[model samples]
Target: MTSAPKPISAIDLFCGAGGLSLGLKQAGIEVAAGFDFDESCRFPYEANIGARFVHADIAEVTAEHLEEIWDGAETRLLAGCAPCQPFSSHRRGADTSEESNWSLLEHFGRLVNETKPEFVTMENVVRLMRMPVFEQFVQGLEELGYTVDYRTVNGPLFGLAQTRRRLILVASRQGEINVPKGLGNGPATTVRDIISGLPVLENGQSDPTDPLHRARSLSPLNLKRMRASKPGGTWRDWPEALLAACHRKPSGQSFQSFYSRMEWDRPAPTITTQAYNFGTGRFGHPDQDRSLTLREAAMLQGFPVDYQFVPTGSKPTLSKVGKLIGNAVPPAFGRAVGQTFIRALAQSIEQGEPT
Candidate 1:
């Protein structure tokens, strides 16, 4: 009988709250460590995934550091989901050259060349494909003798409850590699599927049993606006009196998704760092008269309901926690990537080739 394939080890760069690491661990890859410049990520990353968190800028991480992290493993996988803000839709009209994040992808390419890992993966906003930097990064990987494949994917199609699209790239020194096709054919996961079972709370109320279920307070005008809102409906549905001055402007007509409620049967809009704020997007609950709570936002991101965001005794601030949850790679998508990597490794082993 053929022996089972040996396990592959990985290190996650830009790991945020261990979302990618958690999915990778569940998919049978041993996550040795995670590196990020944000110190806040250390708590949740180490606590939940048990991977040592290295708090340092990616530019400061040397090949020697990765060698130590790899520690002579037969297969080394480096995963980098660099921050996508520089390439996000939100930055469409802005000048991104001055942004420090614009250089992170190139920096990631440098690390890959320095370490020469056998396997690699990266995730980013779909908009990155439109940027020249992304092209350069891909070319750099190809020039280094790595076979690379990348594609844009819809998150809901991968069993996530949110309708987010991302670009995923997988590279291998062993042979050609590609991201696995999504498993979301029958019926897409809906807003009701994930958050309907959670306890109900009033606007600005916190669940006594769960700290993350706390909601932020809304102004009276916004409260009335939410009450007037319907699932899958836009702010346009509101009465003339409740409409904001901006909405009266022609430009405001273009921003119809803001302050809208999510539909129960449909997948939610892409959760953002400000999702807890009702005005950010269509983040309002279908039944509840308030915006989505921190926990709800995390769930939509494909994080387990029990995933710890902050340690006990530490206050959960919306800005901090929201950024962590929103910036995370949906664990479901990460799981798919991890499974693809495992399959590649298995294929190489079966063919009597090194990975």
Candidate 2:
């Protein structure tokens, strides 16, 4: 009898709050541990996922360190979404080669080159495909004998509640492997479908039962603007008297989504680090008059409702918790990647090939 495909375990780099790890575990992969520089991710990463969270700067992490933590499985994987701010479209038209965050992707490649894990996967903003670093990262894997495939994955296509697209790249040393294909079928999930049942909360109020459901307080003027705003509408919907100074400037014309409310029937705008603040993006609630709460944002990013992003007894603040939730890989998308890896591995094993 053929043995089951050797078990696969993962070490998630930059694992904020274990979003990706949770998805991998859901796909039947063991996430041995998670590594990140953010201390705040420790409790949430461990509390919810039951994996060790190593707090260390990725640039300083060596191949030996990864190997040390990458124990307990015959076949292993290295997965990460390195700091992506440097490659974001907002920074388009500028030379990003020298951005400090650029080195984080290189470090991800460096560790992969050095340790030579059997399988590897990475997720990042789609714009990264235009950068030379991405080409180099892919070339490095191919040169090391890894078969690589990558694609831009649409979030809502995969049941994530946001209108976001990320580049997912998977490399395997075992056999030919392809990134999963196709935009998902049929009527996609909507913001209301995912979060409307949440208990209503006024500005600055939190669900007493679920601390993460708290909303940030809105200013009186902003509150008025929110009340007048329509779903899927822009700042122009506001009365001229309520328009911000920037809204009058020609440059601000492009900031249409700023301080806007989400459409109940459509996927949400991309959740960002400052999503708790209404003026940051189209983050306002569909029916309420506040930006998406921590719980709402996390759920939009595909975190389970019970996922804990902070320690019990301590309330979560907007800045710290927002970064964790916004930066996470939507767990549903992560599960898709994990499922692809498993499918490829299964094909190899069924063919009497070693993985």
Candidate 3:
């Protein structure tokens, strides 16, 4: 009889919609539990990922709680992608005095230091490197005797169709660490490459059989607004009468680019939580008459066609599903990081480092 493969186990922190957990599972690791404060995530995280979802604030989770959950597992992997909203490039020129996201990484460090997992991995926006907190985070890992490797990587280089970039950091208690090479940027994946084959829907239409494919309802004024919009066109193309009052001024002309349509032959713009706002970003479909639906947005995020993040009976609203998709680390990127973490650990084990 053939022997079974060795089990790889992990615990995911700040697990939003279980994207990283799902990717790790794809690589043969079993996620024991996911910790997050979003109660809205509980249904999707549990239903789709099949991992125990703890809806507690991370600042309140104790080391004892983690130890009890590990249950003497030989090799424990701790993974997290801290909230990056406060440290994003968009927030650079603004005052973020009220943002609490910066401190979460420190909390992550505290938990890892106390629990002493054999391996660790983290992902975030590239702009985070500019923060003094990030520097201290790297120094803290070295103090704990971890061999760390951190770098920013583009998602499309790893076979993801989107042009999203993220900072990935992997550290091992055992030995040296390095990120894996990119699979190479061969072809630029276009919007058609991802969602082209899916069933087509008109504005405010829904696939009766697939709730997840439903498009958000449009207001009558907005319906008339989009009809005047063209793929790759801006509000400049709209009739003068339909333009927003502010957009009618010279100062507002600069912001006209915000409400634009996506080009058909090019890669879609970065999908954000408010991507359904046709005027908020390059969210309008290339050749279609509607903004990118929740299903299309999820697909562009590298989720498999049949991947289930929302429940069957749940209404797939733009705001709700957008938060779920937007907050998720693209599974393709997650898998790349997971493989690198595993390799770094294996190298450390062979060379006999700290763990």
Tens digits of per-residue lDDT, candidate 3, 292-319, equal 7777888888787777767777776678
| Reference-based TM-score of each model | 0.95, 0.94, 0.88
Work out how many backbone clashes candidate 2 has: 0
Backbone clashes, each candidate: 0, 0, 1
On TM-score, the stronger of 1 and 3 is 1
Candidate 3 backbone overlaps, count: 1
Supply candidate 1's per-residue lDDT for 333: 79
| lDDT of prediction 1 | 0.88
Best first by lDDT, ranked: 1, 2, 3
**What TM-score would candidate 1 get against the native?**
0.95
> Which residue runs of candidate 1 sit more than 4 Å off their true CA positions?
85-101, 353-355
Could you tell me which residue pairs clash in candidate 2?
A: none
What does candidate 1's lDDT look like per residue over 1-355, in tens digits? 4468777899999998988888888899999999988899999999999888998887778999989988999998999799964432234354546344467787788899898898999999888888888889889889999999999999888999889989999999878688878994879999889998999899999988788999899999999999999889998899999999989999888998998999999999999999999998998989789999999999999988888989886679999999999999998878988998898888777788443
Q: Which numbered prediction scores highest in TM-score against the true structure?
A: 1
Model 3, residue 166: distance off in Å is: 1.9
Which ten contiguous residues of candidate 3 have the minimum total lDDT?
85-94
The global C-alpha lDDT for each of the candidates, from Candidate 1 onward, is: 0.88, 0.86, 0.78
What are the candidates' C-alpha RMSDs?
Answer: 3.3, 3.6, 4.4
- Candidate 3 residues lying further than 4 Å off, grouped into runs, are 1-5, 85-100, 349-355
Ranking by TM-score: 1, 2, 3
